[model samples]
Target: MKTIVFKALPFDKTLLTLALESGVDAVLTSADKVEAVRALGRVRVLTPEELPSLALDSKTDEEEAVRRLKAGEQLALAKGWEIIPVENILAQVPDVALEVESLDRARLAAGILERGADVLVVLPEAAKELKAIVREVKLSQGTIPLVPAVVTEIRHAGLGHRVCVDTISMLKRGQGMLVGDSSAFTFLVHAETESNPYVAARPFRVNAGAVHAYCSLPGDKTCYLEELSAGRDVLVVDASGETSIATVGRLKVEVRPMLLITAKAGERTGHVFLQNAETIRLTKPGGEPVSVVTLREGDEVLVRTDEAGRHFGMRIREDIKEG
Candidate 1:
């Protein structure tokens, strides 16, 4: 079993699911506890003091600092986690002149790399500089994973959307990497691509697809469905919360503000088709009969079902309805 290092527990269920699917062998514990080793299967725990080459700068908003630390702890709890003591990790790192700006981050990151740091932590503000250092190490024919410390917020829990995008971007560096965050699970549902060339080092797979997808079609991503035609897979996701429908298959594509439904028309009457001059409806317990609207000659409607409940007919209206 290969060893994988992490600075925090994977709080985001999506990323956690992806990591499990991708075959990561172990998680670096925050406590550096022996029990974590047994729990993670193939594991080796390291303390932060073990590395001497790296340093950490404690400069940031108090709220952000606490947020990042909590995220790390949450990651540990999700996986068999232990602490990587700062003292131990830094001791083994080959000491270098500390830069005034990122003196601490450089030391910590460099120390971990020298001491086999599979996943090194960096402050969010230092993310750009961390990337630069990773590049330098790669130039020397070295490969190491530099994990960023992201400060999460209630508005954007689980590191929200940006972190996943960042992880995908870093995978292009071709190094064994892991992201430790409380919110890593958020994007797991919607991030669908496995083994993306963008980040080939660690091809992580999450159970969920990313709410946002890379659109091959032109124009702003928000307008992807505006000009598209119907009867194809128009993937739509909920960027709002955990409870909402994460992804819904848009059945058809027509003129602006119009749609066609293609999935199951109803649960009792699986796969009903509707093509009318104006509107269509489905008959289901507690379900609104009129499922679609604005149907001209060649329009379609799709319905989907989930564990929560059954959904009927797709909305093909041209006008945006008020919330």
Candidate 2:
């Protein structure tokens, strides 16, 4: 459905493959020859300048720069890909510390939609507000994935003011998992933390029937980093109740909109407070008042979150779309 173009040196074989396998629609450039573009689609251009380099090149910085660019052009020609001269996309960067109050997050989100940014990154402190803004953007505009940052340190114990973190142990080690139920509903959660106390604990079984949608990440990737890079709005649920749904943490993400939403048993309780990068709403259907921003009567909303752990919800106003 999408096409990705790369401008890497011939030597950057690893980078090319990484892009292709990692959900890139197509791989172009980074080869010895260049080609033409056909049917302009979602194009992702990766450059070596943005990525860190190893100690293989010459000590001189100039030599390395020239070598990388030349290799990039060669790779482009070999792959029959278009070479975009300008660079607008960036990767694996730190969170930008912009005040959401100072600028209308909704307005900025609109601009991001216009600019066609692959992802929108917001500070953890302003994640809740950003989630609301993102929801607005998606409702008005098309689906633009949002990745919110959790700009804080990780604490080992006590569950003090921490975002729900996904771990590899949960995913692979059999403690927990990022799985969907037989109905094909998915969620990101810890087995011990979110599971139903009534059921007998299984090795890899996740109690998805209790929760609507959940996801889980490995230990190496923290909650903050996951949400920002994740392509959708992230939902942050506070089991500790130490932090309000409004308060922002490190990273937050919303799941993709295409995914289905099924009702779970426990998501509607007063204890289950959720803040999506797109909107603050409980994951349950026909919910009580936890003050969640939901689509009321034909209102459209945009929801975005990737495997990273970030999410966004956008409420689409029909009036605006009609105008």
Candidate 3:
């Protein structure tokens, strides 16, 4: 959830169109050109009065920046400002904006305090690297630590409700959703990106697991499979733990024979009940899919472990346990 704004002041139509095509969150333009910018695309257009730009060179200026931010105002910092003053303002609030003239400066602004600034104003001079700036700074996410877990048990769980997650974005072979009975330990369920003799490949779908299981989402949140619906965002994680956000296009819930898979990793045991079929798969250690039907007790697969407490999809601090 990072906000990227392209500064279109002085109103260059080419750069405005480029910003729109680059998927910028907002376009900062003059009041006279707001209508023209809106006519081009459906983007948030801001005038100078709406999001004023300033420079923080002295203590008084830094105090003014801090005061404006504390008063619930969002302003942009001019380029050539020092990092210490920005950090001082950021320590108190998280909504301070920074103007950058290059992709490197944008990355630096985004990595401030390890959480980045709430808003990034892109100058028109950086038009050549706008797409790269958005891709690397906005769409990219953090990585998680994935470990090998040995399969302990695989049993027929009989006819049960399962969920199929259909995302708007096409997923690759090693990317899928992480689901399990416990958030602390979850299995990397592979997407249906492989074509078999019987069925065609579904690069947009993941036969995730049972409807009651917990599936990881962005911002370190989790939700049950049954609760996922169209227009919702789910976290798509690869075997290496790199993550991205995918919008749900549809959800399929059906009664299919399920297999309860149990795996153990360093004394921690986790379970994920998935549909019993050849197409249903889990990711292997080398970033390949291993079908559930072909899985054996000794096989090793990729699994993720994290802090377990969650209430209503948000992480919490409490003494709670799940099987």
Give the worst 10-residue stretch by lDDT in candidate 3: 135-144
Candidate 2 lDDT, 34-77, residue by residue in tens: 23211233444433333333232223533443455445422111
- The sequence of per-residue lDDT tens digits that candidate 3 reaches over residues 1-323 is 88999999779999999999999999999999999999999999999999999888799999998888789877899988778888888898868899999999999999888888888999999988999998877767778789999999999989999999999989998999999989999999999999999999999999999888999988889999999999999988898888888899999999999999999999899989999999999999999999999999989999998888999999999998887
CA RMSD for every model? 20.8, 18.7, 1.4
Q: In terms of TM-score, which candidate is strongest?
A: 3
The RMSD (Cα, Å) of candidate 3 is 1.4
lDDT order of candidates, best first? 3, 2, 1
Error of 2 at 234 (Å): 8.4
Evaluation by TM-score, superior candidate among 1 and 2: 2
Against the reference, the lDDT scores of all candidates come to: 0.25, 0.26, 0.91
Q: Which 10-residue window in model 2 sums to the lowest lDDT?
A: 81-90
